[model samples]
Each structure stands twice: as structure tokens, then as C-alpha cells.
Target chain A: MDEMSAESRYADWIAVHAGQSDLRAWALAADGSVRAELTLPSDSAMPEAPAFEAKLLDTIAPWLGQGSTSVLACGLTGLADLPEAITPVPAKPAERLPIRVSANDPRLDLLALPGLSQANPPDLLLGEETEVAGFLAGNPGFDGVLCLVGPRTVWVQISAEEIVSFQTAMTGEFFDLLAGHSTISAAVASTGMDAEAFVDAVSDTLSRPERLSQRLAALRGQHVLQQLDPSVARSRLFGALIGAELAAMRPYWLGQQVALAGPSDMVDLYARALDTQGVSAPRHASDGLALAGLARAWFAMQEHAK
Target chain B: MDEMSAESRYADWIAVHAGQSDLRAWALAADGSVRAELTLPSDSAMPEAPAFEAKLLDTIAPWLGQGSTSVLACGLTGLADLPEAITPVPAKPAERLPIRVSANDPRLDLLALPGLSQANPPDLLLGEETEVAGFLAGNPGFDGVLCLVGPRTVWVQISAEEIVSFQTAMTGEFFDLLAGHSTISAAVASTGMDAEAFVDAVSDTLSRPERLSQRLAALRGQHVLQQLDPSVARSRLFGALIGAELAAMRPYWLGQQVALAGPSDMVDLYARALDTQGVSAPRHASDGLALAGLARAWFAMQEHAK
Candidate 1:
């Protein structure tokens, strides 16, 4: 119960993810079991580098012990800007070495993971790279498109355990803005989405994606005419956005094996859109994948160090 | 001043144009000349009906007389929602009579003007109807199309003084949301758009509209690759959005006499895009058009009342 057991538990490392608004860290046992988790719900992406160490300690300091804890980080990496994130198209997703951050706490050895970027057709992604790496770790033989749908939907073409190329769309952010802030919000009901309406709207826009702007305005018009139900109109607005995205991404997914990752509802929505287009893509729960990717990257680092 | 002069000034009717965020009123003298103006900066689009009078008096109380003054109101009509706003497509702009409100003040006679709407491809406009009407009043023989750009852009096809059909786009609002709030902001400079970049992006997108999302992501990519200037990327993003809009609106403006009305900057952008397509659209400063339309509606109401 004394030194040996304490060493076993305290030898554990942490996997960290800092998003646009929140910070999350997982306390993992030496055997790779997640023993506990900590979350700081705001101001994690503080733009300044100094905020990272304190924000990390605020959540996982109690878990730190006599030995140093290696913290592998991604997303905003607890900072709004990281100068060293790699442009890793045509390279393995998790191949880049983690950047050793200057840690003030001797008990904390922090490493911010490098995010992937595409040089041409320009796009960049942070935490999604880790999730993609996790996906590859679980299915090493996978070789095709992976559509990670989130605040920004990222579509990466993977082959031989590396990302060949990728593109991103603002569909998720646009949907949130339109449904929550735009005048379209008044035309549609706040809570529910009609499945049929969503599919129908997607089909309509996919056939002629340029009509997206018109289709959106039509939702408002339908509201004025008292024609479409509020929920139906809301779903249509959502469908229209995704449809346009799918249209743009046609080159990326068409005639290729596709996989999906993200929040369940988003995965389901993207899956439905793909299903309509006769594409079958396997789905992965994105919540745990970032940590899995972080763990994989850590293990790789250990192997490299050896 | 003397009693007679006070009466002359107080008898002036006020034409009010309330938008989603601001209220503007032009005080018209008895002879139909604009005597003065009033502006209420915020919260003027209060949804409650009772707010109409208090907001009205906050700006134009000094101009009020012992006798009742006709207040022609449009836009949100000092309210967020108006049940009686008419869907009046295929009718002359500003032809609808003002809806009489239940005014508590004997000296405050308020009348809310009906906004025009198209039921078919679904579109609605409040203050824009007044602007179109103002445009028609100034150019009575004009009979083609009007592109009224703002936070929400409206496209109206006119024939024989009637709005035969119309459409609306969220281009302006989308630009604001993307440039100000989305990740795109970090990729682009905060201000100053490059003209060549804007024109080139418009040309690129107008040829392939479905690539709108990709073009946006490319701006972010360009940032990571350090290939494009920040202001150039920003302008390209702006151009891509407008170009997509122009593509969607091809049917609306093709082979038609078109007029552009909006803020000077927006008008210039639209005009440039249209110019790329070899279409020359006359520019109309939208600042006074709303009040002019409101005044026109007020005069028409007076004629009907007589």
C-alpha cells in the first residue's frame, strides 16, 4: 500500500485536448486504463501561451505525484496559436514528433501534439488529426476517405497509414449560426428536426447545390406563407447546408470507401446524407478517439526514445 | 416661434424605417419636403406592440403637435414580429395601405406599412419593399430587376411596376459571421480587402459555385502554408461568397436591366462581380432609399384616406 502501489498509480500519464472553448484531460494508469478525467469548461483557448500550464494544472494537479507526468496535448494545445503545427499532407497522421513545451512545473512534462495541414487547396485541423490517428491505429489496413464531422467537417483521404490529402468545410459552424442567430431562426422551431424534411432538402440541394442560398431564403418565405411547419423548415435549412458540403466534397468521397467520425448525431446526419448517395461508410465514436490517438502518439514517443 | 409657425412645424408627418438593429425616421413637412431626421440606435425592434409609441416619442416628441400626426412606420415597425405583414408579390411595390395601430396617445397616430413577400420560392422583405418603392418612385419607367444588398440581400424582378417575383440570400450575414466569428477570421487580415484577389476569387467561384465551402477552407489552408497574403485571402473569401450568390442569381439578372442598392462598399462589390459577368448595374445609395420609400407609402396612404 506504500511506495510500490503509489509508483504504479503515479507512473500514469495524461492525455489532454483543448478545444475552442474548453479543456479536457484524461488520467491514465500505467497499464493504459483511464482512471479518471478532468474538465475546465472555459477559456482554455486563451490565445496566450502562458495560460496553458496553469489551466492544465487547475484540472489535473491533484493527480500529479513525485514523478513527472507526461502530458500529450492537441486541439488548441491550450493556446489560440501554435507556430509549429505541421503541414502533414502526404504523411502519416501521427508521425510528427510532439513539440516539447516549456513547462514551469517540474512535476509536469508537457508536449503539444502537432496538427495536420494541407499545403495546396488550403486547410488545417488540430484535434481531428489525433482522432484520425486513433482511427488508423484501430484499423491499420483502412485506406480511403474519413469524414470527421464537427464544428468544421474534415474529409481526409488516407492510404498506407498516412493522410494523402484532405479538405474542410464550415457546414457545422454555418448551421449553428443560421439556426441560432440568423432571421431563419424565427421561421423554424428551436428544438426538433424532421428526418424526412432533412433528407428531402439534402436531395434537392445535392441535385443543384448552387440553390443553397435560395433554399435558405425559401425557408423564411415558407414561414411567412405559413406553408411548412417550423421544425420541417429548420430541418430543411440544415439539410441544405450539408447538401452543399456533400456536393463540394463529391470528388473526395465519390467511388471510394468512406468512413465517418464525430459526435453521434453529426455522424448519423453525415451517414444519412451519404446513404442517400449510395455510399456506405463505417462510423467511429470521436469522443474517445482523441485520447486514443494521444495514447498512441505517447507510446510511439516512448519507442522513439528507446 | 409664433403659434402659426409652431403649427406648421408640428404638423409635419414622420416616416419611420425600423430595421433589425436600428430605427431611422425622416420628418416630412406638410408640403412633402424632408424637414429633419431621427435615429434610435438599438432595441427599437421591440417585439411588443406597446413599444411603438414610446420609441416613436423618444425620437420625434419635439416635432409632435396638439393635433394628431400621421406616423408611417415600416421595417420591424418597432416590433420583432408583425402578424399582418403581407406577402404581396406580383403587386406594385409599396402599394399596400398602412395598418392602423391602436394608439394610446391622441396626438400620436401610428400606421405600420406592409412589407412585400413572395410566396412561391418563399421570400419576405420589410424595409426593402420601401427601398424598392423609393427606387420605383424615382425611376418610374424602370422595369427589370433590383438587387437590394444588405445583411440579407433581396433580388426583385419588376415588370409593369409590379414585383413579378423575388428571391433573398444570406450573403451579407454569412460574410459577417464567417469573417468576424468563424475560424476564417484567424486566417485572414482583420481589414482591407485586396481588389485583385476579390475579382479573381469571384471569377473562380462563378465558374464552379459548388466549391464555395472549399474556397473558404482554402483561405485557412493558405494561412498555414504561408503562401497567400492575409488580406488577399480575406478578399478571396469575400469574393467566393459573393460569386456563389451571383451564380445562384444568374436566372434573376440575366439579360435584364439591373440596379444595385445597398451600402456603398457592398454596392461596389456587387457591381464589380456583375461587371466581371459583363453586366453593368447602376448603383443606388441605399441610405435614404428606405425613408424615401416610407414617405412614398405615406403619400399613397394619404391619397387613399382622402
Candidate 2:
């Protein structure tokens, strides 16, 4: 980082969020204040030891020194080595003991953070736990359901600082696959989203969720029969999927204090979808929550050592 | 074909069924008995005139004579040039006028036949119309619904040999895309069908058509948490999708004489899914119906000439 020298102990520590798409690392000083941030394309969803170590070094090596600098990396980066990365729920999000990486570098102390898992509905999360912890850090006494919208949208129930249960929907994956590569890609590829169209489609699908496949085919039919606006078509596709999800997940967000977290853009989309249902979703920056969660974990580990 | 020599009027005419994946054509005698059958990969869903003409000639040229041998073609082969191919419903499936293909070969008389369309529900079918015609040709007095399964599965409401209305579902497309490339592909890539798992999943989703997305996600969760058999996982995934479709199309199959048409394997899958709902779906050889419908169109065209 430009803020400090690279000779020795340049960064006191580092916190990283390695996800399916990319890896984000923040170099932190002793006070847990971030000095600089670096991002790189991820190695894989669940990266192996050698490749994960190489990526971590490439991300943090310039900031490393001859002395030990602890690296607290969360997400799928080192998950394969961390057999305990899936912590059973009804406990703190940061309850699992992060596995130490089998490393060749002397100045490295790497810990792979584990995500939370629920047994009832059979659900698991990769990196959202850190963000949840970060949300909890900001709102210590807050108790409500958190909707984290990302590549995989997760509906989490929280009370007394423990993750009670969660439900995940493959809505994002379906959206990506169908919109990018499927036959509906022509209708889904648009530079803009139509708000009115999105609302209408959401209502339609919410009222009749079972007709989702038929509605998907209708997108193509309407595109062919009528000159359906690309923006409107895209919005309608998203709306149908989100609407159906909301109907299925009514028990999760029907009458609860709800907050939305993720990248602001996607978070806003979910916010708008929930708005149609007359549910107000407060927004939280996913990256900020992630950093906060990582810091909280680091702070707690420090406390445990003390 | 080897059954007939390449000479003048060795075969009276040809009936073709061109679809999204492939094209099937039959050289027939004047009485409509199939002299020989041929199948080739389709040019495209809606191919250009040049490619369609080339493929048609390539398929039928060997059997053509010095005389203008009439070729009656149907499906997506020549659909692009036939804007009027979408024959409006409340009419016979073979009611649309066939468009003549502009050709350089003097001995080939190729005509592109169109399929039936419905406006209310916004549906389209490329080649399924011929199969419906064949079904009607055999059962002129029958009145009920037809489920045509393929790249896109269509449910047609037939009344007294005339098309009433139809619904198109992207179940096949969705199933193909998800099982091939999605994150849960590992769970879906199986070689066998688990009947019990499929039936159970069908009932589960039939009772809860709204929870389709969650059930999809649970496939992955269960695969990871438990020793989920690949075949069972694949069956569960299919059952969920088809179950949801059946729940939506309950009105189409409930208390109706339903016939399933398509490739035998896919038709059997739909047949099984419908059987769970206490509906008996008679299987129809899709190719036979397509050829029969084409021959019927040829016969009617000749009668018009007379």
C-alpha cells in the first residue's frame, strides 16, 4: 500500500472475502482500520490448497514483511482445507474455528473462515456469514430477518445474535443462466430495467406462481408476436422469478423486521421487489458488512488469545 | 433411398417434419405409404431460405426425377420465409396455405407448410402442428388435449379436429440448461431414473408449486449434507419441474382424453408424470403423425387443384 513501507510489518494483518466470482482483500493496521484494498479473479468456488495459497500470496505478498502478519481469509478460498467451515446453526455466525493453511511461507498465519449451515431446510452459505456478522456488528441489539441478495439469494432468520434458520433460492443462478445463455437471452439482455413492467410482472407471478414456466415461454412469444421492449422484457423476467420466490418465501418476510444486504445494485432490485409486497427493506452495503464481519472475527480471535 | 431408383416419378412425393434438433422426411407412394425414411440435423429453428433450400435438396435430390417431383415440407425448416405460417386457431391445423420455396432445381417442387398458433395465451409451435393433424386424421371425431414434448413442450386443446387454444411451457429448455451447466449439474448428471424419488418429488412439488426454487436449491444442499445418490438427485430435480408444470396445467389434463407425442423417451417421461395425477396419456408416434399430416396437406392441395 502507498500509505506504508513494504520492508517489514507493512500491514499488521489482512481480511479477505473470496467468493465464486472474485476475491477482495483489505489490508488492515493493528486498530483494524483498512489501509488499502485489492481484488483479483477467484481461483475457483472451492479452491485447493496450492492454488489458494498462491492467490493469497499474490494478493498480499507486497504488503507482507519478514515478521508474522495474520491473514483471515473467508469464503471459498481455502474451504476445502477447512472441514469445519460449515458450522451448525443456533450459534454465533463466527463460532467455527477457522482452519490454518498448510503453508510454505514463514511470515503467513492464514485462517480459513467457515460459513453457517442449517440442517432443517437443508441450506448452506459460503461467504454471507461474514456479512451477517458485519450487519450484527453495526446493529448490536437488532433482531430481524435479513435478506442477502447476491449470486444466491438467502433469507436468514436472526435473533439474539444467532442464525436461527435460512432459506436459499437459486433465483440468481437461474437468472444468470437463462438470461445469458438460454433462448430467453434475447429478451433478457438490456441496458436498462423497466420499473412499471417489473412491478406488473411481479404481481402477476405472485398471484399465480405455478405458471412461471408458461410465463417464461410467454416472454419469447410476446417478444416475437409484439415488439416487446428489451428493457421491459428483462424487467418482466426478473419480476416473475422474484415474485414467485417471494410467494414461496412469504413465511420468511411476511411480518418481520426485514433488512436487505448485498451489492447495492442487486440489493436495490430486491428492495424494489419487496416494496411491491408492501414490505420495507432497509439497505446495507454487502462489502461493508463483509469487512465488518471479518474484523469482528479477528477481534474475537484476538480476545480468545488474550 | 435404395428402395427406389433415382428416376422419373420413382417416388410420387415426400412429406417432411423439420424441428429444432433434426428433420425427418419420408418418401411416400401415391397412397401415402412411406416408401423410405430419412433424418438429418436441422439447419436451424427458423432457417434462411438458402440454407433451408440446400438442406431440402440435399435430403430429397437423390430420390428426385427429371419431372417436377412435389415435396411437401412442414415445421421450422422454411418458417422464416413463411410469415403467414402461424395459422390462427379455431381452425384446422392444416388450414394454412403452403408457401412455395424459390428454387433453382427444376425437378424439385418444395412447399413449406405452417403450424397452428393461438393468440390469447401467446403461444407458438413450429412443427407440432403436423403431429396434431396426423392425430386428428386418424381420430376425426376425437376432442380433447394433446401434450407435445420436445425442446419446448406444448399442450394443445383440440376440439372436433380443430385447434381451440394452447399453452407452451419452457420446461424442456429449463431442464436441459440447468442439468448441463448450472452449479447443481453434478447432482443432476445421472444415467438412471429413480422412480420412487421422482414420484415423491412430484407429489411434494404438486402440493407446493410455489416452492420450486427452494426445492431446486435443496437438491444441492442435500447432495452436500447427505450421501445423495446421483440418480435420485436427478429424478428429484426433474420431478420438481414437471410436478410444478402439471400443477399449473391441471385444467388441461384433468378429465380429458390426453395423448402424448414426441420422441418415445421424453413422451414416456411426461406420461409417467401425468400418470401420478391419475391421468392416462396415450403415446403417439410423433414422426408417423407428422408424415400423415403432411400427406393430408398434400392430398388437400391436390384436391384444390382438381
TM-score, chain A, per candidate? 0.91, 0.93
Question: Share of real contacts kept by model 2?
Answer: 0.58
TM-score of each: 0.93, 0.90
Interface RMSD of 1: 2.5
Worst lDDT run of 10 residues, candidate 1 chain B, spans: B78-87
Instruction: Write down the DockQ of candidate 2.
Output: 0.50
Candidate 2, residues A106-169, lDDT tens digits: the string is: 7788786776667777777777877788888898867889998876788989998888888988
Q: Return the top candidate by DockQ.
A: 1
**Judged by DockQ cut-offs, is candidate 1 incorrect, acceptable, medium or high?**
medium
Chain B TM-score in each of the candidates: 0.90, 0.91
lDDT of 1 at A117: 68
What value does DockQ give for candidate 1?
Answer: 0.57
lDDT of each: 0.78, 0.79
Return the clash pairs for model 1, or none: A122-B221, A123-B221
Top candidate, metric TM-score: 1
